[model samples]
Target: MAIHRKRFRVEEAIVGEMPSPEMIEEAAPMHSEIMAELRAIRAQMAKGTPPAPLSGSAAMAAIDASTAHELSEARTMLETYRAQIEQCEKLKVELDLIHDAIDRTKREIATLHGKSFDGGEMAKVNGELGAVVGGTEQATQQILEAAESIDQAASAMSKVQSADQQKRLADDIQERVISIFEACNFQDLTGQRISKVMGTMKFIEQHINAMMEIWGGVDAIKAHVPAHVDTRSEDDKLLNGPKLAGDVGHASQDDIDALFD
Candidate 1:
């Protein structure tokens, strides 16, 4: 037995230690005091009782309220700024449309004036004329939309009932009209053609001015006219006379003789 005996060692399991009574007693007062204060505050809030005022606390609260008000005002200002930007974007689109319409009209007029009697020249001119007319028609529709937008914006500005607003609107309209007039001046149409178009435009302008004077401006005239009235026929008649005469008179006599001979 002394020679063959084997010793077996048993290991004890370790257990977690609990906190001491003194430590628990020390922590208990701090926990209860915190809980009591929290309950008191909750009760006061529930009862709608105002908190005990502190020195400088009133000023701080007022400052917080003022900050909140300022923030609200800033938000409102940002919204207004966004709306203004949107309105400006819309106006820009309308302005571009008007410019495009004027360009198309000018191109069409140029094409019509450049037409020749030669078959090849006539064919080329006709194709150009067709394209010009198509562009003009599309541009005209866009211009009409832009005009409507202008009218609406003008009306809205007028309704502001402010002298500054009215003056601004008037100035804007005048500027736009002047720009249109300047654009309409035909630099390409020189010599007889330019003279004729200028004369025609002047005549039209005078007539329109006279009408405005007599009828108390465009609005009055438009109001007096029947809704179904077709004014384009009269306008076309006025436009065509000078244009036709100028074109005929400008024809080369030598070219005519060569064709006949």
Candidate 2:
């Protein structure tokens, strides 16, 4: 038995060493021609037919060049994407900081007011208003009842025939008028009480504004409050004070009565 050795040469292609421009230029035409021919052949062939083989050094070089180009493009794209992602993260952090600032503002404002949205000051104001209303209502009712009594007395006095009876009736009328005048005194007292209540409300409002400044404003208030759906329309948002009793889309006294009925 005879053993034969096949010898191959080793070419040292150092770092950064690449195929010559001449070789690449030479390979280009052949590569284009071959690719064009192959494409034509594939076009002529039936569907699913295996394509022709390309196996020369030039063909390999061309493939390598193409692959390198694709890799360069992919690397560029990856760097761009990374930069974009970094920017997005930065923006997100800034947005978070803005949110924090807003929350802080709201908390400060809440403090100034001595209360929050459903704060103690508001409850106190509510109680005060209720007391004022009750007092006024009671006073008005008493006046009405007194007036009715005066009317009854006048009607009876009108039917009297004697001078002495007339004199007595006139005296009773003066007394009733004096009683009416006394009933009106409640108004002065109620006005004073209302003025006190108004002062309290102003104080509460000023404190609330101070709280806003302290907390960071609306943001802080919202953080402490639970999220609720805003059902008001753009128009409704501008509305102020109590709505009319029988307004559209609102339940009136009749509707309330119907619940019990």
Which structure among the candidates has the greatest TM-score? 2
Clashing pairs in 1: none
lDDT of 1 by residue, 116-150 (tens): 33466546545555655565565556556556656
TM-score of each: 0.26, 0.43
lDDT of 2 by residue, 7-80 (tens): 33333334244555666777999999999998887886756667567779878998999999999999999999
Q: How many steric overlaps are in each model, in order? A: 0, 23
Q: What's the lDDT for candidate 2?
A: 0.74
Candidate 2 regions with alpha-carbon error over 4 angstroms = 1-78, 101-105, 116-123, 185-246, 249-261
